[model samples]
Structures are given as structure tokens and as C-alpha cells.
Target: MMTLSNLTSPFPIFHFIGIPGLEAVHVWISIPFCCLYAIALSGNSMILFVIITEQSLHEPMYYFLSMLSATDLGLIISTMSTTLVVLWFNLREISLDGCIVQMFFLHGFTVIETGILVAMAFDRYVAICDPLRYNTILTNARILQIIFVILLRMIVLLVPTLLLLKRLSFCKTNILSHSYCYHPDVLKLACSDTKPNSFWGLTGLILTSGIDIPCIIISYIMIIRSVLSIASRTEQHKAFSTCVSHIAAVAIFYIPLVSLSLVHRFGQSSPKLVQTMMANIYLILPPVLNPVIYSLKTKQLRGALLKLLLSKNLPMSS
Candidate 1:
């Protein structure tokens, strides 16, 4: 006889999804998730270590790779706290303020990662399209400036939407579709008129991912043109090869993001589990795969990684 209306509190509590209609299997599901979290954490951690310690990886390219790894780590940790506990212990509840904090970093790092990719694209563009300018264009100071702009942009674009959340009323069901706090997921639960939230949210996406994706595409196109102009076929191949890992990184980061957006915007009749899975993929796929992809694709990183592993495993001298 209890209604959702009566259960509403002064401060709302949000519940994260646990595969919807498959609650009985949450414990079993946690196993793979736990393994994934381990891979994400350890893999990114090792990547960071090798990039920092290996003199070979201290170039502009590897510096960007380090930023990519660091951002992936941030993305993983953002969701790990709420998501793992919800699945393992049935602790699905989070207060409004908590949800906002999670959304901030979850989305903040996401934006940072996007910007890093853009910078990486620029790095590649300069290295190939204008080899002489590569050093001057992407100096350590310039990299620092790019990072500062990314952080500043994240704050400029993301903070206002979250700040506005304090003014909304959650009179409806507060259960979010994914195990992490997402902006759209939380925005929909607000009973107050949310046109401003919707507006700024869409505007942020337009300004962030919308602009970044095209810049990457254009960078690649220019890269291809530059490669084709090279007389020796072997050098062209080598130039293209360097871009493979970066291209892969960009694909994994944006594909799920685009697919999730499409599903949410048009797939109203789709199952809740489908949306939940889509959102999970959006968050988990990149962090889980980036380290492996880079390790396998980049010879320098792979070699450094192998050396580090062998050194740690070798027997100590008496």
C-alpha cells in the first residue's frame, strides 16, 4: 500500500541498476566485474609506471599516453566505489550530494580524456604533418597549458549543470539505469522543470565531444595526406603504423559514447537491461581495453613493460 510519493524524502536517495530483472544473479555477475576492475587498475597503473620510469617513453607521445592512462584510472575509480558495492553487497543507495560528486568526476575525467585524445591527435598531426614543428609545438610547457585548459574547460562546462541540481526536486522514482551516477540518469528523476538542465547538458556535449571528435577526424585525414606525399612506401607504412594505437584508442572511447547516446535518444522501447548494459559499456570498455591495446600496439611501451616485468620476476643476487 506504500506509494513512491510517500517514500520521498527531503534529500533523495538514488539506487543503481543491477542488471534489471536479474537481481538473483548479481553475486555471480560481480565476479567478472571484480576481475575487470583488477585489470583496469593494475593495467593502467603499470602503464603509468613504465611511462614515467622508462627514458624511451619520455617523449611527447608517451607523455600524452601517460595522461591517457591517468585519466582512464580516474574513470575507473569514479565508478568502482558505487558500482562494486552495489553488486557485491546490495548497497545500491546513494544520497543526492554523493551522486552529484560521482557524476562530477565520472564526467570530469571523461571530458579530460576526450581533450587528451584531441591533444594526442594534435601530437600525431605535428609529428607527421610537420616533423620540424613537433618539438616546438608540443613542448612540456605547452602540454601543461593544454592540461590546464582541459581542467578549466571541464570546470567551466560541467560545474554549472551540477550546481543547478541543488534546485531541483526529486518527486519521482530515483532509481538510475546504470550502476554509476550519470548526468542524464539523475536529471530525468527531477520533478522540477528541467529544461535548463537539458539545455546545458546538450550544450556541454556539443562543446566537448562534438567539437573534439571532428578535430580528431580532420587530424587523421591530414595525416593520411601527409603520409601519401612521402615517396618511399616503407616510410609511409611506418608513419601510418604509429597512428594505429591512437586511432584504436579514439575508436573505443567514442564508439560506446555515441552508441549510448543513440540508444537513449531513440530506443525508448528497448529493454532497461539493454540501456543499462549500454551505459556500462560506455564507462567500462575504454578503461578495460586502453592499456592492453597500447601495450600490444606500441613496441616501445611493450618492450619497456616486458623489461619491467622481467626485472621484478628475476631471482635476486646474494
Candidate 2:
């Protein structure tokens, strides 16, 4: 028995559509979504565990990998409860404050991950371009400094976004088109002018992922040039082999992200289901596949995971 006054009150609550136009099958769709969440959670947790516990992995490269896993975990957990509850139980009501908080963490973690990937590219560049100076270049203190800089950048960029959203008035419909809150999604629902919010959101994106991708490309070009200068083909192969894991990780992360951005920008005419599905893939695929890609591509990580499993199993079996 809700009144129009309550619905349109200054403290209005927002509702999510949870895959608009597909309500009848939401329960069925939750199965695969749940499985993806399970895999992302366990895989990232395993990566963090192996990297932290194995003293052999206490290097700059693995430190970056561990940070990547942690960011992925944050991204996944940020949307987990809201998304699953909407799809599984039709619970779509969320407070305006709650929506803003979710949007903050989701985009914040994404920005941090992009920064980490860029740092990893720098790691690969140093490891290959100047192997002799790699240790001096990426000391433990330097690694910690890079991590602090990433977090600080995200905070400074996102605080304005939150403030802009806070000043907006939401007199129009409070229904969001997706299962979780995103800056763009939430901004579009505001009855007032959202130019400031939109501008900050785009600014944040360009500064983070937009800048990161080009830098990563430049780093790779340098790495390839360095690899080619090696006197022996065996040395060249060894150098390129070290990069395969990082390259795979970059591909899996950026491809879906770029695709989703394109779809959002140009696919307004496309089916709602198509946009929704692409968004889901963009959010879920990276965390689920990153660990698998590393485990398959990096021999040392695979060996460490094997040893960890064996040690645990031996105790239980005994």
C-alpha cells in the first residue's frame, strides 16, 4: 500500500530490472550466474592463497598478480548479493544511498584493476628490457608505492562522482536497467541534468583504462624489441615465454571491457537482452578466467598450486 508521495519522496528508493524483458526466466538464468560467481570467488581466492603462501612467489610480478586477484575479488563481491537476490528472488528495491555505494565500489575496483594491469605491463617491460637492473628497478618498497598510488588515484577520481550523484534530484522513475548499480546506469535515471555526473564518469574512464591500454601497448612494443635483440633464439623464446601469462590476462580483461563499452555506446538499437548479456559477461568473465589463464600459462604458478593441493591432501589422507 505505497502512495505516490512515498514513491516520489526526496528519499526515494531505486529498483533494478534484473535483465529487463526476461523476468519469466530469471530463476533459470540464476543457475549459470551462480556458477560463474562460485568459480570467480574460488579461483581468485586460490590465486591469492598460492601467491601469499609460496615464498618463491614473493617477487614484484607475483605481487602484482596478487593485487589483481584481490581487486577481482572485490569487484565480484561488490555486486554478488544484489545481483543474485534480484535474479533469484525478485528483490529489486534498493535505497538511493545503497545504490551510490555499490556504484562507487564497482567502478573503483575496476579502475584499480586497470591500474594494476598497467603496473604489470611495466613489470614485464623491466624484466625483459633490462634483466640486470630488474631487481633494483622494482624493489619491494617500489611495489608498495605503486599499489598506494593506484588506490589513491581511484579515490581522488571517484569522490567527485559520488558528490555529483549526491547533488542530483531523482524525481523521475527510479528503476535501473541492470541488476546492479553503475554510474552511467544510475546517472541516466536522474530527473535533473546529469551532465556533470556523466562528464566525471567519462573522465574517470579515460584516465584509467583509456590511458592504461595505450601504455600497455607501448610496454609490449618495447618488450618485443628487447626480446628480438637477444643473441640466441633460445633466449628470445625464454623471454617471450615469460610474457605469455601477462598477455593472456590482459586480453581476457580488456576485450570484454571494450566490447561492453562499444555495445553501450552504439548498441542502443540492439535488444535489451543483448546489452544485458554483454554487461554480465564483462563483469563475470575476467575473475573467472584470470586464474585459469595464469595457471595454464605460468609453469611456476601451476607447480605451486599442485604442491599446495598435495600438502593438504596428504594430511587428510594420513
Candidate 3:
């Protein structure tokens, strides 16, 4: 069994994700990722703007939508800043401290993003399942409190794992197999035994991404049940259409997540570019598609977007 450490001097490692002979692909993907980042930032910014400006959107669903947009923007920034740096330099080596900070923010927003998604799903459930009580149940004060607590908990939960990772000895290998300082990727390169690292990291992942997924499922389950119970066909259609974007967003985000996990567990050392591509997709695609998904599927959001754009054009037209 040839170990990763046994590889030849200089490691012959490609700069992109670990895929050999696929550096060009990484560059190509980076171009689109930049585009995706722009879209995530701009689109989410627009959503935030519309939500804040429009008095009518002060309800629970829009409130959660705003929060979701904010978190998605954070998620994109956290994941892609380090990613773009790696691509620009084409450098595979990250210092231990740099790696730890990257890992910390990367997963910090990841947990909070998952929590935000779960919150949005619950908001939708309340709106659809208990419409009569939606106003009282998801008031501004309550929503703000929930968001604050979730954000605080996510940051606190992620910090200790990051600190634990920082305490490990690197044993001279500074080359990270992935583009960013992923916990598992960094742990793999550690000179010391990694069982503890792997165990805790997996535990963290399960708590954040893993646990949040099931909760999303349950929320949607209730949402679906409630939608079906509506007596009017028009109401049922409206409710289902409202959920289309959320379902699409969930699928877009999680599919890449599953793919990335599988690649990490199975494709370690295969090629750097492949690893890079997976990571890039994991970080970039969801944010890019999120606004697009919601704008196209959600009538209120689409109207708000169009009105905002038209308003900007009015001065030029005059």
C-alpha cells in the first residue's frame, strides 16, 4: 500500500483539486466561478435591498428569505475567497495557520447556512401549514432572536473544532490536497495520528450539514401535507408553486454536497483538478442558482426584482 507521504519529492501534485493533467479545467471552472460569485453577490444584494425597502414584505417568509439570502452570500464569500486565491496563484501549499482559518470560516458559515435553510423551511411550513397563526408565530422579534441564537451557536460550535485542528503537528508537509483548507483534506496531511481529527470532524459535519438536512426534510413533509389539504385548486397551486424554488434550491445545494463528500472519501490522491472542481462546484453553484431559482419561481420576488431594475432604468430613460 503506497502512502501519500511516499510520493516523490515535490509530490508532482497538480494545483487544481489534485486532478493530474487537468489544471486547465480548474482555470476554466474558476472563470465561471467568478461569474457565479458575482451573481450570488449581486442577486443576493438585490434581494436584501428589496426586502428592506418594501414594507409589504415584512412577513415571516420574506424575513426568512432575506436571512437566507444573507447567509448564502456569506457562504459564497467564505468558500470562494480562498478558492480564488488558490486558482490565481495556482499554489497547492497553504501554511498551517492559513489552512486553519480557512477551514474555520468555511465551516462556520456552512453550519449557519444550513441552519438558515432549516429556518426558511420552517417559516414556509408555518406560512402554509398554519397560516392563521403565521403572524404571531413568526413575528419580527421572534425571528430576529432565532437568527441571533443560531448564528451564535454555529460560530461557537465550529470554533473549538478549528482550534483542535490548529493544535495538530503538520510534520513538514504543507501541501494541501484540496484547493481550500478543508478539515478532512488538512487532517489527511497531518503527520500525527488523525483518528481524533477525523472523528471530531465527522461529528461536526453530522451535526451541521447532516442533522440540518433531515430537519429540512421534515419541514417540507409538513409543507407538502398542508398544501395537499387545501380545498381550492388555485390555493393548492399557489402553495406548491411557492415551494418550487425552495425545493430547487435544496436539490441544487445538496447534490453537490453529496458529490463532494463521496469524492473526498473515495477520490483522495486521484488528481488535484478533480478535487478542485468538486470543491468549486460545492461552493459556487448553490449561490449562483439560489437567486435565479427564487426569482424565476417566486412571483413576489420576481416582481420586486423587475420593479427594482425598471426603476434604475427610469432615470436613463428620462
Candidate 4:
């Protein structure tokens, strides 16, 4: 008697062909992605460390930035570490359990990242729109509790989703096209019926991304409205300037993700390289640009960075 579990025991394998034209293009493409990944990791790590050690940055805005930086760092690591291993060593075989674990972390971190972004948006909204209440609204104790609740909810929701995905009998072909075991890619390989998976997966994606994006949009909308109401031109400019970094960061994050989704659903025939590039952009670009955007746009952060740099160069100057 053949059992369903045993039938799916032959874990799937994946491979990338080094086609001549594509290979040449990939070499050039991979360099920048590698650089971006390094920068993202290093920059986010620096932000996290600075925020933790610097008492001056203990305020609500920098506290949220620290949390966001940590999440961004985790996001890049969750995606790129496996990708790097596969790309460099050409290791393609993934056990069923290994694949499931990867999917869980990938999905989990993505959800957490969105939650952190939402938190940051709310922080900004409180800061600019309700300055009098900012202290009460975003106190340390309250912010910590909110982050804890958000993380708890994200984990509790995502674990069941991944477990449900794991329960599906993967009797179909096991060759995953993408570098990671993304939910959509994994669902495509399930031998059992996937209507439930498809429905739930899409629903979850829609609900999560939908909720976070709208919250961000609404925050910025209110911020803009508040900016307009300010009578002083200089104050209005200062208020708007504070949000420029966040806007740049959000656009870089969402645009690539949305584009990748569109290409996946609509342009199935798009070249594999193109798909890979877009996927890498989502994974790499946001983190790479996030710290840069925030640091460069905020005079305080830029001053801090410059001071740190000057301190480092003081011995040489002497």
C-alpha cells in the first residue's frame, strides 16, 4: 500500500541553466545585487547598533527606525542567504522540511516587515499631525507593547498558514522555478487539490498587503493634509522633509514587489532572467536604499553619521 506521505518523499530538485547570452547578462546583474545585499546588511546593522548604543536616539522616531532597521535586516537575510548559497554553489536540492522552513521564514519576515512599516507610518502621523499628543501616543512602554502584539499576531497567523501548506501532498513535479520556495511556486507543485491553498494564500496576501499599504497611504495622506494647514512655510517644509525618506523607502519597497507580482501573474512567458532580476530587486533594493534614504534626508541622522565618520578619522588627522 503506497502512502501519500511516502509518495511525496522524493524531494524536488531545481537548477539554473547558464545559457550563453543570459549567462553574460547575469554576471553583470549579479554583481550589483551582491553589492546591494552587502550594503543593506551592513547599513541596517549599523543603524541597529547606533540606535541601541546612542542615548540621543532613544526617542520615539529613532526607536521606530531601530525596529524597522532590524526587520529590514532580517528580511534581507531571510531571502538572500539561501539565494546566495544557491547562486554561488549551484546547490539546488531542497528537502521537503527544508523547503517548508524556508517558506515559513520568508513569509514570516515579509509580514513582519510590513507591520514595522505600518508602525513607522503611525509614528510619523502622530509626530506631525498631533504633536501635543505624540509623547502620550508613542511612549516607550506603549510602543514596545504594540510591537510585541504585532509580532505575536504575525507569527500566530503565519505558522498555521505554512503548516497548512506543508500538509499538501506534493505528488506533482518538484522542480521549483524560483530560488525560494515561495507559496505560489510551492502550491503549483502540489499533487493534491490546491483550490483551498490558492484561495487562502491569495486571501492572506490580499488582506495583509492590502491592510499595510492602505495604512501607509492614509498616514501619508493625513500628513500631507496637516502639512498644508501649517501657516509657516518653513515649518511646512520641515514637516514634509521629515517624511521624504519614508516616502522614498516605501516606493522602492512596494514598487518592485508590485511589479514582480504583476509580472508573475500576467507575463508568464517573460524570460527567466527577467523574473529573477525582479525578484532580486524586491529582496535587495529596499533594504539597500532604506538607510540611505532615511539618513540622507534627515539632517539629524546625517549629522550623526558625519560625526561618527569624523571621530573615526580623528587619529589620522592627529
Which candidate achieves the best lDDT against the true structure?
A: 1
RMSD of 3: 4.1
Candidate 3's displacement at residue 226, Å, is 2.3
Residue 92 in model 3: lDDT: 64
Per-residue C-alpha lDDT of model 2 across residues 76-105, encoded as one tens digit per residue:
999989999998899999988998789889
Which tens-of-lDDT digit does each residue in 1-318 have in candidate 3? 976456433322222243346566666756866877888999989999999998877777888788778878877777676677656656665556666676777777777777878887887888788889988998889998988978887776777777776555554435665666677766666666777777777787787777889999999888888888889999999888777887887888788888888888987766666776677678778778888888888878789889989888886644
TM-score of each: 0.96, 0.94, 0.87, 0.89
Residue pairs with backbone overlap in model 3: 16-272, 16-273, 17-272, 17-276, 18-271, 18-272, 18-273, 19-271, 19-272, 19-273
Predicted candidate 1, C-alpha RMSD: 2.0
Q: Rank by TM-score, highest first.
A: 1, 2, 4, 3
lDDT of 2 at 175: 77
Clashing pairs in 1: none
Instruction: Please name the candidate that would achieve the greatest TM-score relative to the true structure.
Output: 1
lDDT of 4 by residue, 1-318 (tens): 877766664454433232224543544555766888889988998788777777777888888888878878888877675666565665667777777788777777778778877888898899999999999888889988978977896777777677776666776347665677776767777777878777777777776788889999999999999999999999999998888887787788789888987877788898876877777777778788889988888777777777776887887644
Using alpha carbons, what is the TM-score of model 2?
Answer: 0.94
Query: Cα lDDT of model 3 overall?
Result: 0.75
Candidate 4: residue 220 Cα off by (Å): 1.9
Residue 251 of model 4, lDDT score: 86
Output the worst ten-in-a-row residue range by lDDT, candidate 2.
3-12
Backbone clash tally (model 3) = 10
**Per-model CA lDDT versus the true structure:** 0.91, 0.88, 0.75, 0.77
